[model samples]
Target chain A: MAEIQLKDLAHSYAADPEHTTDYAIHQMNHVWEQGGAYALLGPSGCGKSTLLNIISGLVKPSHGSVLFDGVVMNDISPQDRNIAQVFQFPVIYDSMTVYDNLAFPLRNMKVIESEVDEKVRAVADILELNSILQQKANNLSADQKQKISMGRGLVRDDVSAILFDEPLTVIDPNLKWKLRRKLKQIHERYNLTMVYVTHDQLEASTFADKIALMYEGKIVQFGTPRELFENPNHTFVGYFIGSPGMNLLEIEVTAEGAKMGEITVCLNDQQRRLLKSAGNASLKLGIRPEFVQLSSQSNDESMPCTLVHTEDLGTYKIVTVMLGEHSIKVRLDEEQQVPEQNAYLNFPSQWLKFYADDYLIVTDETGDKS
Target chain B: MNKIQNNRAWFLVLPVFILVAFSAIIPLMTVVNYSVQDIFDQNNAYFVGVEWYRDVLQDPRLQDSLLRQFMYSGSVLAIEIPLGIAVALMMPTRGAMASLSLILLAIPLLIPWNVVGTIWQIFARADIGLLGYAINGMGIEYNYATNATDAWLTVVLMDVWHWTSLIALLCYSGLRAIPDAYYQAAKIDRASDWAIFKYIQLPKLKGVLIIGVLLRFMDSFMIYTEPFVLTGGGPGNSTTFLSQTLTKMAIGQFDIGPAAAFSMIYFLIVLLVSWLFFTTISQLDKNKT
Candidate 1:
């Protein structure tokens, strides 16, 4: 196994790209450690698949070098790179049995018959496809065919990495979880560097130790699930990662602090200085629904709001309230009492995040803004 | 609940039944009538039972032409299928080159069979034609008009040149229908070019290949215009195929009764072989799926 390092990597489908907006993957530098399970998470057309293809050598990036264990691999072919990629659709040899389908890569590498047989059987057993080993691949169900495709990748021992391009798209929902667990088990056993590309947040959170969230062709945040949930480095991440996402409201910097319409918001001196120095016309304050507090009694710190609606989801309730012209959501526990039509909401200072021009401001551990 | 049977539906199908009766059944009945009778004139005829069929079956000329027909059809299928697949595989997959290649390959298939025969007839002449004159200049002594083997070769080559493109076009469409993911997966698997062709391309092209085989078989078996024009069944009847022999029997010599008997037998042979072809290929498909 080898660590994959992408240095100043960028890709553009256009023959001659004059601007960064023309790129499908903007310039970025990142390294995936050996034996790490990582997920490249993004929306459709966010260049996650393009990044996966570049790593697997299926695509050649226009701008920089892809290195494996410090060795430049930009000119190497996929066969020489020794990477296995499973595509979104199940691609199998229709005429071959599942056994032979798994054995295909080994046979291509001229591995001995005995070793090929052992590897194929071992992979089939892991995929729970041993019972249908002799059955033709074309006759199997879609999920079973997908298993065979995955098994083909697993059977190769010389592979340095395995890349999955939404490999579970065609699988049944119930089977998707099982297949994902099996993949985790295989990853642990093989200790192979695996990169899974998907647009699904739940899939990424469950399958990857670290997720790289991409937006507009650039990686906005690369951190653990908890880190991303607690502190999103970009406004896009804050909006994309959670159910009912984070609520953001535009505010103006004032002599006292930051103000929304006529009400003043609580902010530390460093945050006030950052806001004053930012000089950006657009500044936003963001907070997750789970952190927003609602109360019936008005206080000096709480802003008055009009309750638009409340949805009692079995486990928790989501309260949508209007503060001035902005609609903010508050997620309350099932045990918490619901507020009436008119209520006062408080944005906890510790949970409040400030964004200047859509990018989160970097703050020190001592609460001093950078 | 009881379901009502619609008897009025029979009236709606009457037009189709009348069309089939006039077009198919009536002509078939006429052939059967002619096969079982000794007809001296349109109105003067005598029932001869199975005598004409027995005589026609025992004829040596019919046997020879049947064997020749089988050999020709078999050769056509053998030469065309592989050649067509190779041509299709080598064709460019996209852009202007692909379009240009498609138009170029389609040129021969658009020519009428009779015109193809006429073109080859003049093109294969030893004295005036480039192909024959070049071969004769090299001292190979090629003359399709006088030699039986040369005539057969020229006829087969002409058929291959005129018809191989049809099979290639069918296979090209089939190959194009395969998704790009298969190739990507194969490449990741490190499959060699031959293994990719054998496992991926060949299996996917099976459906179109079956169509090509059946069409070429049926057409070559019933081939008439090209050979009849080029060879004229000359050089001691060496190039006389089934259709030529049957035409000589019915029209050249006007032996309507025996010719009708032979026609029925030929029709049965073609029908039986086509049924066998369809059933066997479909059975293989079912077994896999």
Candidate 2:
């Protein structure tokens, strides 16, 4: 396995592109370590799959270079790249047996018969496909067929990396978890450089060592799952990486503090200086619903708000609050009795995130201990 | 779920069944009747039982035509299947260029069968046609009208040109139906071009290729228009296929009894082959299920 490095990479489907906006993927540079498991996570229409394709040599980026072991692979064909890919749906030869499907690559490269058999059997064993080795590949169930597809990629040990493009999309939900676990186990055992791309936040977070959060053809943040959850660098990342997503309330910043409609909240000296020089005095405060504390008594550091509605979500109660015409969501404990009337709510100062001009302004990182 | 279930929908199919009964079934029944009798003329006929069937089955011409038909169809399929797939492999997979290429490939398929024959006939003439003129100009003797090898080559080439597109189109559709994920898997596997084709493309194409094979086989077996238009059974009987020979006995000879028996045998052979094809395909599908 080799470390994959993407340098100044930008791809544009447009001809004679004039600006960065014309590109499908904006310029970015990052390195995925050798034998590392990484995930490219984004919503549909984002450039996550495009980035995967570029690395695989299926798509040649309009700008920048992709390096495997520091060697530029801009013009290399996919076959020569020595990367194995598993698609969303299974791609197996129906005419060939499962053994043959897995052995085909080896056979094509003119590997010796005895070795090919050994390799095929080993891959089949890993994929739990030994019993179905002699059966035609098309005769397998959807999930089994997908496993055969994975085995076909895994059989060849010489590949630089194995790329999975939403490989579990067609698998049953229960089966998906098992396969993901199996994939993680395989990666750990083999130490293969595996890159998985998915739009599902849970899949991305749970499967990869590092997750690259993407939005609108750009990689907003690439970090560990915990890092993404705790300190999202961009507002988009904050919104994307969470369940109900982070709630951002627009406010006016001043010397004393910020004003959210009629309420004026006090800020510390450092927070005030940061907001003053933050270019636009207009700022937004972001806090995840999980971080928002609901209290019965009013506190000095808390923003007073009224409860609007509560949705019981089995484990917790998702309480909606109206703060000066703006709506915010807060999650409360399921066992706790929800405030029935015009009860006051509070936003903890430690959990507050400042945003300016739609970008997450990170002037203050002193409060975060996690 | 509470929508009306109307029986009036059967009216849409009534006209088709009537047309088919008159145009297909009645003529088939008439042919069946003639196969079991001896007819001297339009009016003078007698019941001769299976005597004619036995006599026609023993004819050497019948054996030759059947052999020729098999060779012809087999050769056509052997050449067309791979050639079509190869052409499809070279085609662009996306954008306006791919669309344009598909439209261009579709042109040959849309051309009338008799017209295709006429085009090949003139195109292979030694004195005038481009192919014949060019080959002769290159100091090689190539006359499709007068030579058996030349006639066979011309017919095979003509059939390939006429039908390879159909196979290619079917293969293209199959190839196009494959999601990008499959290619991704192949890429990461470091699968060679041949591996991708064998393990991915060929298996994916099994359904359509079966259709392609069946259609091409049936068409090639019953092919009377092109070869008849091009060579008229040739200088000898070198190119006289089963369908042509059957037509000759039924129309040229006008010996109703033997012709009827020949036709029945021809129909049976086609029916048997089609049944074999269907069963084989169904078996493959069943194994998959």
lDDT of 1: 0.90
Q: DockQ numbers for every candidate? A: 0.76, 0.48
> What C-alpha lDDT values do all the predictions have?
0.90, 0.85
> Which pairs, if any, clash in model 1?
none
Residues A12-55, candidate 2, lDDT per residue (tens digit)? 88987898688889999989899999999999989988899899
Pairs in steric clash, model 2? A83-B188, A84-B188, A84-B189, A85-B185, A85-B188, A85-B189, A86-B185
- Model 1 achieves a DockQ score of 0.76
| C-alpha TM-score for every candidate | 0.94, 0.88
Best by DockQ: 1
Question: How would you encode candidate 1's per-residue C-alpha lDDT over B3-119 as one tens digit per residue?
Answer: 999999889999999999999999999999899999999889999999999999999999998998898899888999999999999999999999999999999999998999999
Per residue, candidate 1 scores C-alpha lDDT tens digits across A1-370 of: 8999999999998999999889999999999999999999989999999999899888999999999999999999888897888899999999998888999999999999999999898888889998999888898888898888888888988888989999899889999998899889989999999999999999999999999999988999999988788798788988998877899888888776678886678788877766666677589888999999999987878888899998999899999998887898999999998876569999888788888889887645435332
